[model samples]
Target: MLLRLPTSVSETQEYLTQGAVPIGGATLVWATWQRDGFPEHAMSLRDLPEANTIEPETLGAAVVLNRIDDRVPEVLRRAASTVGTGAVRRTATVGGNIVGSTLRCLLPAALVLDARAVILEPEGVTETDLAEVVAKRQLLLSLRWNTPITSNYVKAAAEPGGPSPLVVAAALHAVAGGGTLLRVAVRSEDEVFSETAAYHGDAGETLSTLWDGSLGRLPVPARELVGRQVTELLARPGGR
Candidate 1:
């Protein structure tokens, strides 16, 4: 197998056109390889400095998961923390977490935040909605989002710090009419894909409608439990 190290996005794009696959941290790449041998050519983004930095509104695709804990909003930080143990986080890249698996906690957080992705393609760079970018399987350059008024992430997992079977993330923004706009995203094990929904009204009403409309498909008891958890989270002072 040939591993190509590209130090810049342009170089990465060039290599990609030559049938090279871009890999960050290689967590998912290695797993796929374990199941179905290595590819003929692999491009590693580890040496690309531009892909590893975190800014106020942008997070580089190659940034390690652990690096985001304190640097980003609380919802995303909390989601990042649950991705795995410290060792796993140290080697997992934000890009990989976003694109590698939709089941991860970060995807819901990103969805609620209305994050967009900077994608690098052979043609050039293009910006697109995070969800759409993931659906297209585009090579991610970075993720960008504006800070929300408040946000919260809640996950239901089989074990402490284990991969979550269900994740719910909500972000709120104060509207001009003394009401709050709420965006919620839910990911569950039983579903083939995750979904995000939005509502605007009194917190209680919004939360109720969100639960009833988006999570209604879930069993009644399970839906009630998730609804309560999200309600309590948003009800906290300052959404702490």
Candidate 2:
């Protein structure tokens, strides 16, 4: 029932492709029948203890987690709730989503926050922007960064799974002491898997738009919507 494969998501993908139903982080499919008709081959992410943490040195931006209870940001933790169901979030790993490209709720926030991932390849350990890593094929060992901006996440769920609000958006600004540096990221599953960014020089407009969009009623382009939402966040009167 217990089988510990290589820690890499790609290697694990191979097993899944061969009809191995994964029971580890980010995936908890229950297979009625295995490829070889075995009861189960429980894959363990815990076996690879090295793949842990969001890497605090990368601070204020990188919020990685193996379980939903780990030290990730509140926005990200709330984002995880938008995934499939409680069972899925319970087993899903942020690293698995980053490397495997499954549930992507956390990515827009990470990308908007300028988060990067630290990967462990056969060659060696290296760092890459999270967007690029998601674009390419690589084994994500850990994600490292800091989340240093007041931000918001927006997504609209439809009634009975309708067509609107397959959209998601995120906004982030640098921390105080010249926090005008802003990054707004948007994603629409209805559209292609492209993450668009809007880097506005003024934090005021950025925060304003971000808050408005996150709490807004319309489905706007990820870029423009994120901009509006972020603008609102920054424009708030009390040093928001």
Candidate 3:
């Protein structure tokens, strides 16, 4: 396969605007690629330093999954560890993960993190909510979030190494009036449900309500898993 290597962001943007696909780690693209169905033009982002830096409030799109553990939030790290084996993590990138899977894999944790995407488009650069970019599939440059809340995640799968049936994430952060704010996200098979509100001494209820609204009649097992994780998140340092 022919590859275009751009030495600078401008050159990379030029290639992107001309309909070239941007490749970070390229793990996802190569994994699902069919015979003779590869992109006509693919530009590698490895040479672009901006897409690989890990900052306090920003995670570049080309950051590999394994490096996320020490550089990113705890909840995000946990989700990244579950993507695949160690070798896969080494080659899979944050940007590829964001575009490859809708919300089931890493997006749930990112959602609770209040993440936003810095996208490099053909026209120019723009900042957008992470979920909004799900449909656009634009070229993401980095991810940014302000509030680093205490949060945790839980996933229930039918078998060992099988697909997760239910995945839930909950977070607690400071709000006005000296109270806490609760943000939760649930990733089911093909959908994602989320809710955020000022903590009024009722987090489990909000989670259950969101589940019921999104998927009618939450099963006992799913409820228990979500409850345990939410309980842990609330008990974390400075939570509630």
Candidate 4:
């Protein structure tokens, strides 16, 4: 397959005029080709300068997405690294994680961190709150956040060979009041994709539930674990 790459969207469109196919991530490109037809020609944004850097003003010195590896914060980098196997990581952009319009485990930490999404559409660049973007499907260009918080990721998948998330959660400490923020995102594929939130005084039990739920061993609902229900249950000592 021939690849007609561009550093700018304008350049990509130019190639399209020349009968080239357009793509962002190669995986998406390949998927489109397999599901549809040979792109005739393909355009990729890999050469763009915008895809490389992460700005701190946006996210309280959040780590750059490309550099999101073991060297970065454990929770954030682990989320990035664990997105898929090694090959997928090598080519997949951070924006791809959020744009798929599915519930993801990594993004909740950013929501808790008060992150914003930096989108560069054909119109121009615009920023929107993460929550707003999650409410619908929009092509995303970049992601931004504004907090320095401890974060964690949890997931529950089926058996030994499934791609679906039975349940997933990402927890973050809030920057404002030193409180804990818990974001639980779930995807039942054709069923639903939703995010629920709660504040935690002590996140230990919530974390336990998230960790276990990701592994399909959860006994508590995400709302209860992150909400007041856990506290009420604990108050009774031997309560469910």
Candidate 5:
């Protein structure tokens, strides 16, 4: 396989347009490669300055997980902190996390933020909801979101050296006309079990409508734990 590390977005797009894949962190790459095999050509975005930018409205695709700090948002910080051990956190990239299906710790938090992604492809740059990016496993350039008001996150225990924990994350935001909107997500290891709630008056209404009784499908232990977490999270100041 040929590996091309491009330093500019234009160069990167050129390579991708020619059918080269983008690789970041290489954590998921190595594993998937061992199982499947390598692409004919791959491009590393490490040298692209745009891939490392971190700001309030944007998180670069190659931004290190460990670099996410308190300034971003509590829910995201909490999720990033617990993605894996220190080594994994330092090595993992936001694009890798979003693009690869292996790890999903950040998905719940990102969903609750109502994030959008800027994507680059053989065609050109396009912007869309983050959910679409994850679904299609597209090349993500950056993630963007409005700053949230109040947010909370909870997760199940992770085994040592394990993948992401089961996460239930929520955040509140204000809409026009002085009203509050809430976003909520439930992510298991393999799939996102619940659709993100887009602030339905209060937690109860949101939960009832969004969950649509799907909580009953989880194993007893998970159901109970997630149940407690949902209760506590909504009961806090944000839900009302």
Candidate 6:
């Protein structure tokens, strides 16, 4: 396998145009390579300092998951912590988690936070919603979003600290009309439900509906447990 380390964004883009798979932390790529065989060419983003910085409202694509857990909002920090253990978080990049698989713990938090991805294209750099970027399979440069007033993330898995069957993230913010704006996103292996709504005071019912819709197909007992977890998260004072 041929590996090319690019120090600049333009160089990375050039290598990508030549069909080199972009490698950040390589946690997912390496796993896939073990089964599918390594690709003919790969571009490493580790040397690109520009893609490794974590700012208040932006996270570079190459930033490690550990850094995100340390520096981002509570909801994202919780999600990042759930990605894997310390060893895995040390090697997993934010970009890798975002683009690697739909089951990533961070994606639901990102969705509820309304994060946008900065993409580096052959033509130029562009900013777009995370969902749009995922749909188009664009090359991500960074992620940007404003912090919400309160946010929480929860994951329900089959085993302790195992991969989750359901992940939920919710954020609450003050709206212009003296109401609270609640954004919730739920993700499972087969479906994703992301919605934002305004509520006068309490948002319990709306949140319950969203949770039911997202996990309705699961077994009754499993769905009930998820519902209880969501309720506990929403009931926490100061959004925990």
Q: Sort the candidates on TM-score, descending order.
A: 3, 1, 5, 6, 2, 4
- Kindly state the number of residue pairs that clash in model 6: 0
Q: Please provide, for model 1 over 42-99, each residue's C-alpha lDDT reduced to its tens digit, 9 standing for 90 to 100.
A: 8877788777778767788888888885567777888888877799899988888888
Output the lDDT of residue 238, model 1. 55
- Native-referenced Cα lDDT, model 3: 0.74
Error in Å for residue 200 of model 5: 8.7
Highest lDDT model number: 5
> What are the per-residue Cα lDDT tens digits for candidate 3 across 1-240?
568887777887799877887776776667566644888888877767878878767888888888885566777778888776799889888888887654347788888888889888877778998877877787888888765667787766556555565887777767756777777777765577777756556766655555656433456666577667777777666675
Q: TM-scores for all candidates?
A: 0.86, 0.64, 0.87, 0.62, 0.84, 0.84
Per-residue alpha-carbon lDDT of model 2 for 1-240, expressed as tens digits? 657565555665555455443333625234433444544554444445456544333321112332543255445655666766666665666655555544466676566556677664545667888867777745565655565455566675656565435444444445556534555555565332323233355655444554455323324454565555655655654225
| Clash count, predicted structure 4 | 5
lDDT (CA) for every model shown? 0.74, 0.52, 0.74, 0.49, 0.76, 0.74
Q: Give the per-residue Cα lDDT of candidate 5 at 73.
A: 75
Best by TM-score: 3
* lDDT accuracy of residue 35 in candidate 1: 91
**Per-residue lDDT tens digits of candidate 5, residues 1-240?**
898887877888899878987777877788778789888998777778877878876888888899988778788888888776799888888888878845577888888888888888777778888878888888888888899877777778877667556777777787888776666677765667655445655656666654565554666665566556656666766655
Give per-residue CA lDDT, model 4, range 13-113, as digits (tens): 46655766434455444665688778556655566555555454232111223456543334456566656666766665665555552435456445544
Error of 4 at 213 (Å): 17
Give me the runs in candidate 1 sitting further than 4 Å from their true place.
159-164, 175-179, 190-201, 237-240
